[model samples]
Target: MAAVRIRIDLAYDGTDFHGWATQPGLRTVQGELQAALATALRLPETWVTVAGRTDTGVHARGQVIHLDVEDEVVIESAGRAKEPPLATLVRRLNGMLPADLRIHRAIEAPAGFDARFSAIWRRYAYRVADQPALVDPLRRHEVLPWQRPLDLSRMNAAATDLLGLHDFGSFCKARDGATTIREVQQLVWERDEAGVAVARVIADAFCHGMVRSLVGCLLEIGDGRKEVAWAEQILAEARRTSSVHAAAARGLTLEEVGYPPDEALAQRAEQTRGRRVLAE
Candidate 1:
């Protein structure tokens, strides 16, 4: 049977999810999403590939994924004859998914789109309310309440030293056989409209715990606990250190993922999948 690749754009509050991946006995975004897709399409099972895998309590505003299904299954199970299969699938999946998760759109994927590797960059934002009074009750789950006041200038100065391609071992949880080298396209700290300190980080990809750890280290500098030079020193160390702890997961949100033009999609995917190494 012929298969059609479907692309799904979604957003979710990750507070109640274990993470993006399916884990045994854990309620996860992947587990919930896959189950709903199967039920909606009347399929035995289906698997999806995500643009990036977020950690527990890390939210996403622009997550993307792709899955292949038999063409006949989509058409026959759509329920409404007039509506397109992809549109019906979106409505059905959202109806069954929990309130925290929502599918924004579902459509046929462009040729050569891999969801994961076809992307050029992933952007994330971390929010911290340094002053107790600045913490909004409604956004408490998404923002970190910091005990000490933060110096945004100091944080941005410290952040400047960590950008560009480098081995980010100090900021990442060591993973077997996975290189810690990554190209950071952007990293900066600034205050948002509500006076909350926000760190915007964009990179080709991130290793486990990189963003949170970077935030934690920078926070130390922001609060005057660590010197401005400390960030560069840690990066030079090229391995995780005892001084750096990953910031609370709740503060982080994956805000966007960027992909190349259609003609470059396959090439970009192939390049991203290649093994990366940084020169000494």
Candidate 2:
């Protein structure tokens, strides 16, 4: 009757859901996944911890979550299949999940595996169709339409000064008792084959609305409305200002989540539990 922790790698089109958390009446990724998991595993209820809690319209390509379930149930889920239990579990999960959501992999978690806390960094990508010709109607849900064409070089240049550890208060929504200090490992803009601008931002952890706000600020510089120094000046002030607009959530996607080696998971989780503060 021992319980086994399971790690799930999945993706979802967040166009219609109300984000990742469960709500009383609204449809959410967490709610849908938990209901499907409970039905597939024949459990009364299920709970999962997610690596990142995305906004309502934001999508995800490489999301991670963890749950604990009875060991017998997992094996029994295979149900006469010759494949491994984990493989069967994933296959069965996908069958039960809605078309917008998918289960890529599901396996027994290693010791100390905590999906949220064990994550070392998260990568998010935002796509913008700055011109009418570049806007594709077929992919309307994931891309944002902008008023002006974006300059990739300008956005990349302006992103350099915002890298490394800094208080991102100007780019984040205020949260009680939460520090906005974060280490931005990467922030670069590039154009896709369709001539749409794409921004890839990676950070140890993002405060609420951090990536969207950063993209909004860089977008102005990319369009020649704001100078490169504006980004640095905002960071130096470390306070939220009206100049930094939060880009549309539909444009942003959680691309990946990085984690340390299995042996370090416990330590990393413990370290992440402490509240962060900027050094004086």
Candidate 3:
């Protein structure tokens, strides 16, 4: 039987899991989800491909993944005759998953849809409460509390200079053989009604540790510790620097991922698979 590609939209509180990927003896979102799916379908263990691999303690509101399984596995009802097999799978998996994780939807994927490679952009938001009064105890898990007050004007000004395509090595954890170059479609700082500082960062893709490192550098500039010119200087270096610390993972959340239309999925995937380099 032919394999069926399934698209799953999920959300998770990453505080408990090690991260998105699975590792020996570690609790992870992928590990738990895969285990639950395998059990529900009565099939062997399977792997999933995610659009974004968030770091430890990072949350995701719009995470996406895809997995391929034999058609028979998806159609098996497991004695639940009331609903279709796909619906049954969703209901059963949700029953087995922990409270912090949720599978929002499951459907047959469009042709050529790849959760990771076909993605056009990923949008993330970082929340920081610079003033003690603005920090809400209920939101402590998702927001970062900082001792110093932040200047929104300064942070926005610094963020403006960092937009557009460029090498972001200075803001990424160095990984061997992985390119540090990325395109920043949007990076803006604003204060919400609650007076908490929010940074909305949209990029074609982010290298490992890129979003938090960018937030850390901007926080310094907002608090008067670093000059506005500092961000530009760091970008010019095109290499990682110790001066920028990755912001606490608790403040970051994967907001959304964008993809091309159904007809263009394959083309987009092909384009993304090519090695990326800054134009000369």
Best by TM-score: 1
Off by over 4 Å in 2: none
Better TM-score candidate (1, 2): 1
Would you list the C-alpha lDDT of every candidate in the order shown? 0.94, 0.92, 0.92
Alpha-carbon TM-score of each model against the true structure: 0.98, 0.96, 0.98
Once fitted onto the true fold, the runs of candidate 3 whose alpha carbons sit more than 4 angstroms away are none
Q: Write the per-residue lDDT of candidate 2 for residues 225-267, one digit (tens) a residue.
A: 9998889998888989998899999999999999999999999
Model 1 agreement with the true structure over 216-279: per-residue lDDT tens digits: 9999999999999999999999998998989999999999999999899999999999999877
Q: What is the lDDT of candidate 3?
A: 0.92
Show the lowest summed lDDT stretch of 10 residues, model 1.
Answer: 78-87
- Who is ahead in TM-score, 2 or 3? 3
- Cα RMSD to native, each candidate? 0.9, 1.3, 1.0
- Scored against the true structure, residue 189 in model 1 reaches a CA lDDT of 89
